[model samples]
Target: MGADEKAQNKAEKLGGKVQEGLGKATGDREMEAEGQKDQSKANLKDAGENIKDAFKK
Candidate 1:
């Protein structure tokens, strides 16, 4: 994957982790779930990028 895509995915994953931690600390289930969703979306995007890169090869 390109540098920009990688950076965005990393940033999104990091943001999700921070959100999850905060939610756990605050005892907010909704926030925690949202964070998990964000992380999943980021992972999906990363996988798609990897697939595209593989096809280009």
Candidate 2:
């Protein structure tokens, strides 16, 4: 929920997007799947932070 966590989550999401793009370009299905999973995990963490922040208000 803190700034560091948010930054890390954002970085991870960006990395996942890059990975997915690279995988698709190279025709690597496994890599694409992994990237999607990473993106999902990052999104879930972001959602959790948002929920905590909302409760704090």
Candidate 3:
């Protein structure tokens, strides 16, 4: 994966974590679920990137 993608993924993951924390603090179930979803999507993207890079190699 490129540096930009890596950075984006990292940022997204961190944002998700922050969102989750905020949700928990504010007692918002919807926000917590959205945060989890975002984290899962980011993780999937990272996994896809790794697969693509492996194929390239």
Candidate 4:
């Protein structure tokens, strides 16, 4: 995976974690769910990148 793509994915995951924590603290289920979704999307992107890298190898 490219460094930029990896960094972006990491940042997205971190942001989602922060959002989830804040949502939990504030008792906002919708926000928490959104955060979880964001994290999942980031994870999927990272997995896709990894697959591409493996194929390149």
Candidate 5:
């Protein structure tokens, strides 16, 4: 994966973590779940990009 994609994925994961933390502090189950979902999506995208790169090599 390119640098931009990697950075974006990292940022997304970080944002999700922050969101989850805030949700937990506020006792919002829905927000916490959404944050977890966001993190998972970002991780999946990163994994997919890595797979593509491997095939290219």
Candidate 6:
């Protein structure tokens, strides 16, 4: 909902994507799982923000 929060979430998601790609390229299952977890966390944060914004309205 906020610009800063949005930016942080986007950055986190992007970082996760990069990490995921790196893991895939190198065949690291642990790293790939971590990256996926990061992405899921970022998504959850974004969803929470959206819910808060909706309540604000």
Candidate 4 C-alpha lDDT tens digits along 1-57: 999999999999999999999899999999998899889999999999999999999
Q: How many backbone clashes does candidate 1 have?
A: 0
**What C-alpha lDDT does candidate 5 achieve relative to the native structure?**
0.95
**Residues 1-57 of candidate 1: C-alpha lDDT, one tens digit per residue:** 999999999999999999998999999989998898899999999999999999999
How many clashing residue pairs, candidate 4? Answer: 0
Q: Could you tell me every candidate's TM-score relative to the true structure? A: 0.96, 0.92, 0.96, 0.97, 0.97, 0.96
How many steric clashes does model 2 contain? 0
Q: List lDDT for all candidates, in order.
A: 0.94, 0.93, 0.94, 0.95, 0.95, 0.94
List candidate 4 stretches off by more than 4 Å: none
Error of 1 at 46 (Å): 0.4
Candidate 1 stretches with Cα past 4 Å from truth are: none
| Candidate 5: clashing pairs of residues | none
lDDT by residue for model 3 (1-57), tens: 999999999999999989988999999989998888889989999999999999999
Tens digits of per-residue lDDT for model 5, 1-57? 999999999999999998999899999999998889899999999999999999999
The 10-residue segment of model 1 with minimum total lDDT is 29-38
State the TM-score for model 1.
0.96
**What's the candidate order when arranged by decreasing TM-score?**
4, 5, 6, 3, 1, 2
Worst lDDT window (10 residues) for model 3?
29-38
